[model samples]
Every structure is written in C-alpha cells, then in structure tokens.
Target: MASAITTLAADAPTLSAANTGFMLICSALVMLMTPGLAFFYGGMVRVKSSLNMLMMSFISLGIVTILWVLYGFSLAFGTDSGSLIGWNSDYVGLSGIGITELWDGYTIPVYVFAVFQLMFAVITPALISGALADRVKFGAWVLFTALWVTVVYFPVAHWVWGAGGWLFELGVIDFAGGTAVHINAGAAALGVILVIGKRVGFKKDPMRPHSLPLVMLGAGLLWFGWFGFNAGSWLGNDDGVGAVMFVNTQVATAAAMLAWLGYEKLRHGSFTTLGAASGAVAGLVAITPSGGAVSPLGAIAVGVIAGVLCAMAVGLKYKFGYDDSLDVIGVHLVGGVVGSLLVGLFATGGVQSDVAGLFYGGGLEQLGKQAIGVFAVLAYSLVASALLAFLLDKTIGMRVSEDDEVAGIDQVEHAETAYDFSGAGGGAASRSTAAPAPSAASKKVDA
Candidate 1:
C-alpha cells in the first residue's frame, strides 16, 4: 500500500515520534489477531478436535516470527530483484539495521515496519489451518507453515506491496491485504484441502461446533484488532487517509453483519450466533483492501455484496464435494475477491488518490487491474499450495490415521483435552465425588 510519503521519500525524510509510536501499537494489535483466530477456529470444530484446531493457528505465531526476522522481511520489502522477489544484504537476520533508521521515506523505524508486517505474515498461514482442521498431522502443518511462507507468502507480499514488484508496479490497489493476505490464504486453503482430502466424515456426521461463545469472543477480538490492521497500512496518520480507512472499516463491518444475519434468517429460518460472527468477519475481509479509497456508502454496498455472496459460497463446499471444515474458503477467498474488485467500481477519487472507479466516472481500467491482481494471486497460491501438500502427503504423511482421528486428534496430537471429564466418568474419581443432586425421575420415585 503505497502512500504519499512513500512517493516523496527521496526528500530526506525525518523521524516522526508520533507515527512510530502509533505503528508499534498497531503491530501489537495485529499480533493479538493470531490468538483471536485460534479461538475463532477452535470453537468451530468438534470437541474432539478443539485443542488441535487452536494449536494449528497458534503454531504460526512461533514459526513465522522467527522466519520473519531472518529473511522474510528482506524477501518481502527489501530491494526488488527482477520484480518477482527482493534481496538486500543489510536485512539478513535484521542485523544491519540501526534502531533509529527510518524505513525509506516514512517516519517510522524500519524495525517497527518489519514487526508490523511480521504480524501479517504470522496470521496468513494460520488462516489455512482452519480449512485443514480435524485431520492433518501437527508436524505436517508445522512443516507446511515454514515452507509455504518461504515460498508463497514472502514472494506474494513483495508482489503486492514491495517497491517495483509486479502488482505494486502495475498499480493494483490492495490497500492492506485483500490479495496478499486473505486471497492468498484462502486460495492456498482450497489447494491444500483438495490435496489432503476432506475430514474423516464428509457429509454424514453432525460435526457441529463445540462452542458458539468462543467463536463470538474470537470474532469480537478480531473486530477490535482490525482497526489497526487496516488503518495502519497507510504507515502514518500525517494525512487523513488513515482516518478514512478507519471509518470505512467500521461501516463495512456493520453493514456486512446486518446483511449476513438478514440472509441467514431468510435462507435458514433463523438468525444464528454463528451467522453474526461469520458475517462480521466477511465484512472485515471485504473492507481490508478498499477501505481507504471507497466512501462510507461504497463500503456499505461492498459489505452487503460480500455478506450475501460469502454466505452463499460457504455452501458450495457441500455441493462441490470439498470439505472446507471452517468456511475459510467461503469467507476469505470470496470476500477478498469481492472487496478487491469493488475498488474499481466504488473508488471516489476523493480519497487515497485522484483515481475514480467506474461509478465515479473513471471507467473500467482500475477494474481490469484489480481482476489481474486477484486472479494472479489466486492461481499461484492454489497451484503452489497443492504441490506442497501433495509432496508432504507422499513423504512424511499429512493426515492422521483414521483410528486416531476418530478417537480425537487433540488427545493424540497434543496429549491433552480442552476439558477434564474424568470426575464424571464411572471410575475412582466418580466414586469419590459426592453426587447428591437428584433428577425429576428420582424425585418422583422417592415420592
């Protein structure tokens, strides 16, 4: 996401303590999203697999952070190498950068920028884990996280945001990460799931979420952190673009939540807590890329469209026979595409830049550029991710044995359960426990 400061960086930029402090806080907020995502995905799985699901997301925090400090920041934002990747001797291991050195023309230190972007890197691969939940081996997921970020995420980040990268140079308007983060993760999810196959039971099992309250809590945390994720992409609040993005993020999220609940009521005969949580996330995804450029009215339109489309898309897994366990493909892939493309239609030219979208009389050029960015990221991530999963499946194995899966992946993989029910079991603990409570049947019999 290029800003006016980025363009004018050649003017010998000075440090702005205010912007630096703002970005550090934003980085912290983004970091919280990984655990929030864990709770969100964890709650959606069966009780048998809840801990495993949470671990899938939480692992990325440990894995990606170490990798980011090493070469990830360099490959993503270092000097461009042939418009496909990046490299800089100064960025290896983050060793050469001084504490006070600002990032190019921006006021924030390079360290601040690196850490903020590091949060995005950590969460992107974690997103894929949701689609593969309840079946994949923990070791395989960890390996996949390390390899996928090395290959897919780093290069894709460069393409979308790095200086002189193809999409960035081509003027793709991914203000935050519709293409780089959401679409990239969503498409990779589809690819890996296709290779790894569905969960143990595809359609026959009930497989309902173990906890709705956990999902709601996670969704609430994500909503709170996203203000930083979106607004901070501008790098500074020197201009009001960051403020506009902040407003649009709220507007689109609210609209999407309402739209999703409305659709659920009509289509399923009830408004569910799951629907509310999922709809809010869909809106957040849709607004990520276009929030800075679109008006509040445009954000509403984008939210409504994304909420409805994603709500419908989640059902496609059943009809198409792909078991996206947690609707990652539906909410993220479809929502990312919707938000990225709408930028071409809803851009007001009054924000970000003087580039108007179709409705604002800028015609279809921006739309075409957006389509190119969207499809390019989708195609690459899908193919590469599938190949990675296939190799892992053929080698060390990606899925657990059917016996282990049925018995509960959490117990097999983590050697622990989310809750302890031994006290209720008919064993020594149960014998020792006092059970004076009586049911209506016992009361009637006693009477």
Candidate 2:
C-alpha cells in the first residue's frame, strides 16, 4: 500500500509548472496594485503635488525590488537565523535556489515565490507613505524607504512568515499578512506621522481628495488584485483554494463597504465616494488575516466590525492631534486589529489545524493566543518603526523644506506634473488659462 501511494505520488502529473505560472501571474497582478495605490493616493492629494504622491508609490517598485533581490529576500524569507531574522544561506543574489526547487512543499518554483513575495515587500512600505503625503521630501522619503525596509519590514516579515519564526512558533494564523503587512505598515505610519508632525494647515484646511474618480479607480484595482493577494496565500492549487477564502473575500468586502457607507450616512448625512473606497479597503484589510481560517459569516462579522471601527478611528487624529494624514491608523491599524482579534471568536471547524476558535467551542485559550499575537506584533512594530524613523531623521533628515512643500513637490522634486495639457490641444490651454491661482489674500483667508 505504501509503495502504491509512493508510485502514485511520483507518477502524478507535475503540476509544479502550472502552480508556478499561476503564482507568477498573481505576482504581476499584485504589482499592478502599486500603481492602483498611486492613483488611490494621487487622487487624495492636492493637484499641486498629485504627481509627487503617485511617484512615491511607483518609486517603491524600483527601490524595493532591487533591495529584495540584493538582500531583502534573504533577511525576510530565508532560513531562520534566530527569532528575529533569516539567514542568507539558501538563496543569495538568486544563487543556489533553482527555478525548479519547490517552496513550502508547493508545486511552484522558488523564483516564483521570491517574485510574488517581492510584490508584498514593495507595497507594504508604500502603503505607509499615505500618512506622510504632501509634506515629506522626495529624496528623504527614498532614503527612508531603504532604511525602513532593512530595519523594520525585513525583520517583521521574518518574524511572522519565515520558517521557525517566533510568531509562527506561537501558532499565530495570518493568512495574508494582517500583522506583517497591514498592522505593521499602519503602526509605522502612525509613528512616522507623530515624528514628522502634521502637514501644513491640516485640520484648518479643507484638504479634500483632488479627484474622486482616481480614488474609485484605485479601489477597483485593489479589489481586483486582492483576489491574488488573498487566494495566492494558499501558494498552490490546493483543496483550500475552492473553499473558505473564495467566498469570504467577496462577502467580507461587500459587508465592510455597506457598513462604512452606513456609518457615513449616519454621521455626515451623505454617502461620499471616498467613504465607499475607504470602506472597501478596510474590509479587505480585515479579511486578510482571517480569510483562510474563518467561515463566510465570520468574514462578514470581521468586515462590518473593521469598517465601523476604522470609520470611528479616522476621527481620532483630530481629537488626539497625531496627524496620520491619510488615516493609516484609522483604517489599517484598527481594521487589522479587529480582524486578528475576531478570528479568535469566529474561526470555526477544521479550516485550520492545532486549534479552534471560541465559536467552535475551543474557548478562550485560542482567543488569548490571538490577542497575544496582535499585541506582540503591534508593540514590536511600533517601537522598531519609531527607532528606524528616528535614525533616518537624525542621519539623513525626513521632511522637506517648508517652502518646497508650499510650492508643491511635483515641480520642486520631480520636475513634472501629473497632467500636462501644454502640448495636448487647444482645450488644454483654455483650461489652464481659465483656472485662477489662489491670490495671496485668498491664501491668507483660507489659511
């Protein structure tokens, strides 16, 4: 019987190629999300610095990719060095690991895993830039990304995802990086915002998103790419692929969106497009950690709670004066916590091994474990991120000159505009001429 099973397993059609192809495609899908993020953030900033905002996200594609190939991957997913980092033995500069080697017992090339994981590395820090927009110096921001990844992101990724990681040893379940990605990024964002101080004329100015359409576009792309982000967490074509995660992703996002809009209507008397987009993202974040472990009903509960809690948290910046400019703390941090904790309550049946949640009558022990995981990730990320930010600030500076910020970063830093109608057509010139610059008097009045 053993020989028969071994023969069957050996003779089984090599699905490794197929899995590799799917994962590579998924990696590309996730890469597109950075540009989607560009649009998402670009739409939220004033037109003067819109291109700069977009560039911040796009730049990550180049910077993080290079670093990942160089040593970022080694530090993150390599063999465990200790509880905190990974060793550089397995694959350095893409050396020993072959295109055919399997990763995590999956029928995918190691390179496929590397590239796919690279996308996550690229986007995680980019997500934090939203909180520091319209103020940070572009050059300083680049330096910060480089250092931040090495010090904070790489270590955290190892802690949560790397084999023999401390968090993994604790049996913490993070399907798609609630602790590693969302909570990690969100906590860092809050830390940086506090360190950097508020953007000029933050609360006093009615600094609304410049283009609602762009925000909507980003949300759409993020929603689409999230299929890869969540489902790809499976890492192979497994039975789980057709199970809990598929339905959970859809229902959770929908429930979150409705909950967010409902809150907006109750509070502001109108369902704004921005609210819809943000709510969708909040739902996505909440579902990320629990998608593989929880049922559809659990996903709905997670999504609704995340949306409402995140919505409420957005108001915290104003009250507490932290200046998380784009509500990174509001959405990602709060939503991540909600999802991570709630999974303890709602995870049912045998979706995951070793333990079950409260709803499954596994009781409070699992809940305590979940809470410990959340707090541990939160505390480590916060302190480590703050230290990293401070080091960058002290060594190379973090924010730009006040004058450069007032004039906008597009022209001052990148020497480009988000929209150039100068060479387009007659309508472009007419539009430019028709728009009036805010007069000094008006600037003062608005200020």
Candidate 3:
C-alpha cells in the first residue's frame, strides 16, 4: 500500500515546461521587487543618502545572488540536517541536479527552482536595511548581508521549507513565507536598528520623502511582482489556485490601501503619499501569510486590518524611541504577525483540513498554535539576529564614521555618485554639491 501510494504520487503529472516557463517568469518578476524596494526606500530617505539607500538593495542583488549560487542554496534547501540546517550533498555548486530532476512534480528543472528561490533569498535581507538607513557603513552592510544570510536567513529558510524542517513537520502552513521572509527580516531589522542607533537627526528633522513619485513607482512594481510571489508559492501552474491567489493579492492590497489612508486621515488630518505607499505594503504583508488559505472576503479583512494596524504602528517608533526609520517594524514585523495570527481564524476549509480559524469554528486551538508559532519565530529571530549583529559589529565594525556619513555613502563608499549632472571628474565642488543638505525639511517640498 505504501509503495502504491508512492507510485501514485510519483506518477502524478509533473509541471509542464509551459508551467515552469511561467514560474521562471514569475521568479524574474520577483527579482524586480528588490530594485522596486530600492526606489521605495531611496525616495523616503533624505536626499543626501537617497542614492546610498538605493544602492543597499541593489548591492544585495549582486552579493546574495553570488552567495546563493555558491553555498547559500546548499545551506537553505539542499537536504535536511537534524531539522536545523541543510546538507551539502545535493546541488552543491549546482552539481548532480539537472533539468530532468523533478521538483514538486515539475519536469522543468531543479536549477530553475534554485534560481527562483535565490531571488527570494537576495531580497529578504535587503528589506531590513530600510530601518537602519543613512547610518551604517556600506562595507559593514556588505559584511552584514554576507553573514546574516549564512547565519540567520538560510537556517530559518531550512526550518520552514526543507524536507525535514521543524515547522514543516509541525504542520505550520506558511503558504508564502509569513515566518521565513517577513517575520525573519522584520525581527532582524529590529535588531539592526537597536545596534546601529538612530539616524543623525531622526525626529527633529521632519525627514519627509524626497520623491513621492518614486515611492509610488516602487509600490506599483512591488504590487505587480507580488503576484509571482504569492501565486508561485504553489511551485507550479497546476490549477485555479494560482489565479485565486493572484486575485486575492490584488484585492487585499487595494483594501489595505484604502484602510491605511482612512486611518491616516482620521488621525493626522491629512493623507500623505507616504501613508498610501506604506498602506499598500502593509496590505501586501498582511495577505502574504493568509492569501492562499483564506477566501476573497478573508483577504479583504486581513488587508484592511493590516493596513490600519501598521499605519498606526509606524508612530510607535517615535512614541517608543526605537527609530525604525522607514517603519520596517511597523509594516513588515507587525503586519506579518497580524496576518500570520489571523490566518488561524479566517482560513477556510478549501485551504487545508487540519487548519481552520476561530470564525471557522476551529476554536482557540488553532489560534493558540498560531500564537505559539508567532512567539517562537519572533523569539528565535530576535535573539539570533541580535547575536549576528553583535558579532558582525565586533568583528568588522558595523558603522561608518560621522565624517563619511555627512559626506554621503555614494561618493565615500562606492566612489560614484548616482547622478552626474555637472559631468565633472570627481572634483571637490562636485563632491560637495553631490551631497544634499542634511536638513530634510530644506529639500524640495511638494504641494
């Protein structure tokens, strides 16, 4: 009977080349999100460091991509090792695994999956840098990403996605990385913020976004790319499930956008562009965990709730004095937790039999399980992240000098300015003019 079942499972039609082709396209779509994130973050920072902020995310594409191809994939999803890490035997340096090797009953290629997953690995750590923008050394960030991916991200990824992962064994259904991506990155963001300290001026400066249009553009790209993110989690273009997830993704984001704007208008007397962008992200984050599990109505609820909650949570940085510059904690960490927890209550019977929420008559048992999962991931992520930051700080130093910061990281660290309007070859005037004034209020004001 066991062999018969195995035979049935194996005989199931693998994802066709066309399906794999779609997934590969989806992966590329997801890769675009990092640059979208760069724009999103770049526009929000003071102009002095806008280019630097953008560079942070772009650098991850280079650094993490190389690392993933080398050994990152091995540590993340190669094979199970005691439920903690993955073994190096399979797919090391892309060895032995060929286009024929089946992944999730897909005949496409394992390498395709590896490359797709690599994009995700590249972007997750980049998401955290928003909280510590304009302060840390570029060199230090390079080192931090290199170390963080190896120590923090890869292990958590293994635990959630690997064959023998603890979370996988425990029946924790993440659907698309509520715990691994958002929560993990959010927790790490909190740690880095604690270690790196606040931006130079922080609260007193009214550091409004330099380019609202850029933020909106980034948000738009992220929304477009996220279809791949949530839908592709199914690992194949099998049925209507992908289409369902895609639609939910759109609805939830729109609902959250409205919810956030409404909340902001109620509290602050005006709805800023920043609020709109942040709300869209909050919706996206909230729906990530529950998108595949819930119905369309549930997606709307999750999105709206996450939007309002995260919109309010952004103020917590000022009230509590944590200095999460762009509200990584407010949007990702808090949004992720809210969505993850809510799925326990709103998940319908269509997603899974073992999973049902409070409203679905599953009672508090599932909620308790969700709470436990949330706390466990939060606690583990927080401690692990702090230690990683501390160790990196002690070893390679985590911050740049005040002089370098005031001068701007683009010229100081990378020896290149994002723009060259004057076309001068590295002159003093060029350097001086390249750096925007430190006072965020003095820059361009939008009507």
Judge candidate 2 at residue 443 and give its lDDT: 96
The global C-alpha lDDT for each of the candidates, from Candidate 1 onward, is 0.95, 0.85, 0.84
Lowest summed lDDT window (length 10), candidate 2: 237-246
Cα-based TM-score, every candidate: 0.93, 0.91, 0.90
lDDT of 3 by residue, 260-297 (tens): 99998999899888888999999888888788878999
Q: Give me candidate 2's TM-score against the actual structure.
A: 0.91
Error of 1 at 392 (Å): 0.5
Candidate 1 vs candidate 2: the TM-score winner is 1
**Residue 91 accuracy (lDDT) in model 1:** 92
lDDT, candidate 2, 246-300, per-residue tens: 6888889999999999999999999999999999999999999888888888888
Residue by residue across 1-447, what tens digits does model 1's lDDT show?
A: 468777776577788999999999899999999999999999999998999989999999999999988999999999999999999879989999999999987999999999999999999999999999889999999999999999999999999999989999999999999999999999999999999898777899899999999999999999999999999999999999999999999999999999999999999999999999999999999999999889999999999999999999999999999999999999999999999999999999999988889999999999999999999999999999999999999999999999999999999999999989766658787678959889999999998
Q: TM-score: which candidate is best?
A: 1
Of 2 and 3, which scores higher on TM-score?
2
